[model samples]
Target: MTGQDTLETGESVRYISASDLRGFVAALFEEAGLPKEDARTVADNLVCANLRGNDTHGVFRAPTYLERVRNGLYAATPRINVEETAFAARSVDGDNGMGAVVGTRAMQEAISVAGQCGTSLVSIRNSNHYGMAAYYVLQALEHDMVAIAFTNSSPAFPPWGGRKPFFGTSPLAVAVPAGKEQPYVLDMAMSVLARGNVYVAAQAGTSIPPGLALDKDGRPTTDPKALIDGGTMLPFGGVKGAALSMLMDIFGGVLSGAAFAGRVGNPHMDFDRPQNVGHLFMCFRPDLFMPMEVFKSRMDDLVATVKRQPRAEGIDEILIPGEREDRSRRRREKEGIPLSTDVCEKLDAEAAKAGLAQLNTTPAPFAGK
Candidate 1:
């Protein structure tokens, strides 16, 4: 939802700077019981999502998180323990910690082990929503590794045939290095759109595009509120996407010893229960399979070829998977992130509860320009 509208009361919305918003969130987490480092990490990840134009996974989720912490559904100081196994694979028990912190730590371990054994697989259980999967996959780039990351969440959609929800809006991310151009990164959910997107649309009083979601009775719906309440998100490309989601559930959830989609409870509205989300991370040292230089060169060539493809009548340029997001991130980092009025209100309430000073109400230098 675009943050452009005037309510009946004729009040205009204000946007908060990304840094200020993140600082406010960090302070709230600190007050809620997270350690300084953990709080900072979570704050950075959330803000990064906003900067990258992924509002669904961004600071917009702060209110629900705060509510979860307040209700004891999430522990501020969780003990993240690792259980090692053969084949360079490991299992991580997040102990109900913030997903960003747990995901970062897990990817670090995967990178380290992959450096030694050529490849490593790490499965994590009991973590919360870790924001964008790209965040973790990109972490492996510095190590000259190809990274793959996946996560399974509460059921927001059904399996190919079934009416009831049975699969999480699972996401998959892959990152490949490039020589001169930006790294080739692909991050996408198996569903047509993320559940958070629907919420944002609903809050802004907008209707979603048709065929993206299904109503409570399993009929196609365009109403965001209906999709948010009991509706199910449609899988991308029908059965193919649903199949991939199931595979992600197996690799991320079952392998991590965490509950599957239908088994895991919703964390957004349910503040008193754990979500038991799961994630899988894999990193491969390019040198082990092929020369790093060769991989990077091929990736650069591939990206250039795709961008050179003919465009449609109205299209000016062909875009790569992560190109738009990377550009958006650079722009937002220099300017500031945007927030809807509802999100701003929630942030203000959270800041007050944590005894943090209110954020500046001025719009970011780059907003609406």
Candidate 2:
């Protein structure tokens, strides 16, 4: 087929390769003052996000992130320090660094420690937006480790039964490596939708789905603008989702001595102070309970069994966790990733402002599979 699909909101978009997007993003960040290595890290993460079809957490956020770094809010280069350390756990201070950078460092520490200790947990504070939680999960997957990642973000939704926003849309992710099947990767936000999707909608001049968000007055709304302007997002599964959000705040923010209870600065709005976002990363060898080959075989069997189960009416097939995204990534790698016209224009304008080259794009129209 074509590129499987493109543009979540049916907006006009142009397709480009992953390498080109990564280069442009890295160059943009470097021009904005981040170190080359750090910029490349962030670029790779963003491009991976886009390849997985999560444009909300993808390069769509570059402008906002770049602006925050250019302003005094985010440190261009901060000292990532371990505030406390133990054999199997550690607490870190990001020193107001970019969230993705801090998260990458923290997750790397977790993987390194877990390699020797069998398991490791790393908590970090004073960070900014860390993008997709699954990015860290993929890092662990590279090492054949089971991984769990959590992060608390800006206040976007209310607690259960409350009208006013009081909780952050904390995101959670888990990954388990497999031999033949696609690895198990589950990444979800506590809110009905991540606020980044709302930002993306606003960029595309489209409205959000009804029941996904509310205006400031607690009335149901589809207007992304209204949702961002003091509006509130609904929890994914009502109280259950709210309860999980609380856990993320505990593990990522409160337990890490970072901002909690809706105190994390909004990356889109709060410029007076640092986001001080928090993250938790846990990883362990999959063979802790058995041989490595046995674990892999078990995972493959589980996936095969699940895929053999009967499907509902009109269903074509059963997809395990992360399978759809993995499929999207494969298609995008060959056909190219799609960037919305709106986002492209904004990025090009930003690049011109920074005296940098605009996105080097290949013209490929959206042709749904």
Candidate 3:
């Protein structure tokens, strides 16, 4: 089933089943030269973003991914290697593989080491764009472990007070499990919002909200196109966010022996060069200091306690981070994912270029009320 949302501005959004979208994306990836397993892995990560309502990181990225593959910037089949293995830490070289594939392997190692040592950290370098950070951390929830993930990307933002672009969005995500409650997941970019969101807006011909971006001269602007034209993104909370972004750049990039600060290449801008992005994933058993059940109970209690707090003016209820996304995922699973017409058109065009059949352009409305 599917649903349609008509904007006041007369834009009509069509909802496509997640399974359908995933299959189509996988087919496209295969046609672009990825192994069938790798194709499915990439498809699953992108569809997960769509299910969580983060369309900026979803199937819309297929074209650029294929372009990189064709340009020899992204390796369709990579030989990822593990180096400097320790009791509780390790480093990985991605061999320029797709981030989803590299990240899944790295996170699996973290989970394995954490199972034996109570904690583990894995650093990865030379990977291409990894989909939503939450996808990796959420893997730890199944093992009753807490997870934290971070990644650095090509420079698209400046230092706190400086005007020159110096760091990528540098995203971070954390996840913890709770008994009888949805796991808490917090995923966010250090920037005000992901740079991909600006690209999405540009494709949809929508205006970005004021203050989210600056023109090439560092002057605030609402034009999404400006971001594509060498503009900079504003950090989420100015100095604080900028500082956190810098930290991610240092640990996730520089310390990992990947590209850092301005040295990183952007798949969009520095297409001729490799991105050499870096990621960090850490996981630990929540029961390291307490019983697993005890930790889960306390987490549930904390969520309930926060929900019972006095409501603020005009606010319905306080929500835990990732709650909205969980809700969105459930709703989308039943009603299908809403995609802008512009996005479908782009996908259709990409499929044609890849010698694959076009995806269904019309969304199927949900059968239920």
Candidate 4:
């Protein structure tokens, strides 16, 4: 699916205010069965995706999640249970709850434990897609702790050599405190690009860059639809990325005793089955390894030094990971999140099907600027 395939000629796009969208999604989740607080958490996470320019995992996924809930695949009232041990490690059973809610709870638990133990690990099983991994890691930053987060998803890409899909676009995120600069964050999937990026490119009728994905038969292809239909995504930078992805799978999937990529069901296509996704979270109090003040000052110096490097001819400055995203988020929060015509239509259809009032398409408060 390319841009031309989805966008009609001369069709204009409109923006949706984040607060309105967040409220609507929260209402939808509550109507579908989640508790009010849990619904709010899930909605916030989903909206954050759009705010950060990751529309593929944003509200676009709500319809599928609702369908799964209605189909009895995901429990409306989940019973998340935890098992703790002596090693400052814990395991949580999501009991088929919304991944975002469960993941947030897991991180909360990890942070709490880390405060007591100086470091802690939490693994979650039987969860679903949890939106961006960075959101959960950032939660620990408020506690002045360094954090790591990982999650496994449905099989969308193949192992390095094999043609068959055997791994999810497993992702890892890390956050570290800094003194003067913004907190340092790194979040990325092992794949060359996120599946959401491929879908967005396909919707825009654009060819993906080379080396991103392969067609169904394992041949490299720039067409986005090829990636959607039984194609494989290449790992970033070859073997190293693949190795990291495998490691994430082990920590998030295998260690959590949850289904790995091949065994986990796809949420997009398999509406009647639980995704059984897994996640790993860890928090390390800076005071545990070094003085919090010293660590933060060092991080601030590191960021400043990197920003001082020579830039390309047209570029003014180099951006560390999460810097640009943080800027975009602040701007969008005040300006509103832009939704392409295609996404707007999809949201409207979902509203109609769910027997809810349609979102107003008129220019919202943050539309123009």
Candidate 5:
């Protein structure tokens, strides 16, 4: 997919086609023992993130995934199992598998069940980082259904009013299909910033915005490295975000019978054991609640009404949550994905370490920057 606008002056970057990036990533995963199809699925989900401006959750994570595979902390050939199944619910055991694989299977199962039962929910355990939650919810949208997803991660934030880290930057995502408008998708972390954003900032040798996190001693700081040095992320809001993060911890971790609070391992560290991350997926067919035709028309009307709102000074137009991402996806699909020089270097190094063919391109440097 094509990237956004060109880089600013003095900004060094390279552009890679989404298809090529996907092939290289899939090859690395395949070399690490994942089935070809599973590798491709994972690659597609990651690359799609880059195409949609979520570089924090995209191929920048390849090195970490490779390291986990090499350490045997992440199972490349996992034996996924369905622990329990009911009319509209299920429990899945990921067997320490990649989050993309486990989440895809669980969401697919939920979609199938929802098709027959009108709604479904699936809980997954023993999964690794699932990349972006949007990837899974979008899957349901493709089937003309509404989807909701939640996942817990390594400890990065503290409980409300506490300094010790006990909660993750848990994420929640929801998506709904539309008739004449882009699907409505909302994907976000409960922390002031996603932990991945701090990693990205560190990679770029940049400081995070003030108030996002604290230093090792619990003093507020902007240094991205603080996140790696036992610092804690601030909640997005004073107490509300912490409440949501805690709720997700209960639903995704405790409810799924997986590791929660500080017990969950970080995928990039603590290689002695798997992350044992947890996820929850829910799907519903709109037709079950209203006629399909009426639902589509109403969604269109709702979108138009929201967009028609008056704009403030300096504002061009009001856009919905997923509109910008949808535009980015379509543009990148025709152009190409942009990767900063540092990210490209990391990916190249990963390819060499994996004994796979490195990207064979003489990237055209961004002009002027």
Candidate 6:
């Protein structure tokens, strides 16, 4: 089965199976000089984002990633090195590796250390733009450990009072294991929506809803391309989102000796130099205070209590955080991922440039073969 969607611009979208998408992306990366394993790692991360309904960070980014790797701005096979700073704290240098690869290794290090020390923090520097932050947290969940992830990007927004691009639309994710209910997974961006959302709109040639962005002169605008050109993204809730974004920079960039305070190079725009992105990953044993099963039971209770509460007007039901994404993942697993043809065409062009075959996509939506 497959899916399709229509955009305001009249561009049609179709579904691409996860395996086919992964194979296409991996083959493109391999053709661009990445090792087979590293290419698949990157593909998996991007496809997982798509499956989880985070299209802004999904395979839509293949062109930019391939460009960076081919140009040497992003290291294809980086020499990842880790330095132990404490029993439970480690610092990692990614050697400008692909952000997904760097992040996967760093989180694995965190899981290993937390297994031995009950808690661990692994700070990373010199990485590229990692995809959705939840991927790492989910990795920790597979090991039955609670995890938190933070990463700072190239600055694309402003602080509370200023309009100059000063803060990255930084994001953080957290996950907790549960016994009978779905695990708690939360991924949030400081901005009202990701700047990548604007890029997605721009690529589709559609107008964004008003007030999500401001022009360089601080006037509200709805033009996605305009926002990408010289405008800034509005942080959600004005000051609070700005504050959390700043906090992410402190944890992910400042502490890790990576670029911060509007200095991290933009992964898409700053091709002249490395992004030098930073990430902070923390994991802890859920059984630190009680039996693992008991902890999971409490988590299940937490979710049940929330779901049992009265629903708000027009709300069908109260859903725990990550439930929507979990549902999307399950549905996509069965019905393939819906991707805009514009994005598909771009990916196909990139594959052609690398002398690889184009991606396979379904023409109709959810039609049984």
Q: What lDDT does each candidate get?
A: 0.83, 0.88, 0.86, 0.83, 0.85, 0.89
What is the Å distance of residue 339 in model 5 from its true position?
0.9
Number of clashing residue pairs in every model?
0, 0, 2, 5, 5, 1
TM-scores for every predicted model: 0.93, 0.96, 0.95, 0.93, 0.95, 0.97
Estimate, for each residue in 61-146, the C-alpha lDDT of model 5 and write its tens digit: 88888789888888898999985567789999999998899999899999998999999989999998999889999999988999
The digit string of per-residue lDDT tens for model 3 on 1-369 reads: 122575332457777789999999999889988999999999999999989978788887877887898899999999999875788999999999999999998999999999999999899999878988999998888888999998998887899888767888988999999998778899999988788888877766778889888889889889989877878888999899999999999888988889887787787677878889999999999888899889989999998888889998999989999999999899989888877777677788888887888776445556474
Model 5: how far is 212 from its true place, Å?
1.1
Worst 10-residue lDDT window, candidate 1 = 1-10
lDDT of 4: 0.83
Off by over 4 Å in 1: 1-13, 364-369
Clash pairs, candidate 1, are none
Report the CA-based lDDT of candidate 1 relative to the real structure.
0.83
lDDT of 2 by residue, 1-369 (tens): 123235658776778888888999999999988999999989988989999988888998898899998896888888999744787998989999988889999999999999999999999999989888899999999999999998888888888898877788888899999999889999988987887888888877888889888899989999999988888999999999989988889998998989999899999998888999999899999788999999999999999999999999999999998999999899889878888877788889888988988877655733442
For candidate 6, the per-residue lDDT at 78 reads 94
Report how far off residue 218 is in candidate 1 (Å): 2.2
Model 4 lDDT at residue 248: 82
Ranking by TM-score: 6, 2, 3, 5, 1, 4
Candidate 5, which segments miss by more than 4 Å at Cα?
A: 1-11, 360-369
* Candidate 1 residue lDDT tens string, 1-369: 224543332334456677787787888888888899998988888888888888789888887887887888887889999889877998899999888889998998999899889999999999988888888988898787899998888887789997777898888999888889778889899888888888877877778889888888989889999887788898898899999989989988888888885777687765657988899998988888578888888888988998899898999988888889999888877666666667777887888877788666654355456
Work out how many backbone clashes candidate 1 has. Answer: 0
Pairs in steric clash, model 5: 1-332, 1-333, 2-332, 2-336, 10-369
Please report how far candidate 3 places residue 49 from its true position, in Å: 0.1
Q: How does model 4 score by TM-score?
A: 0.93
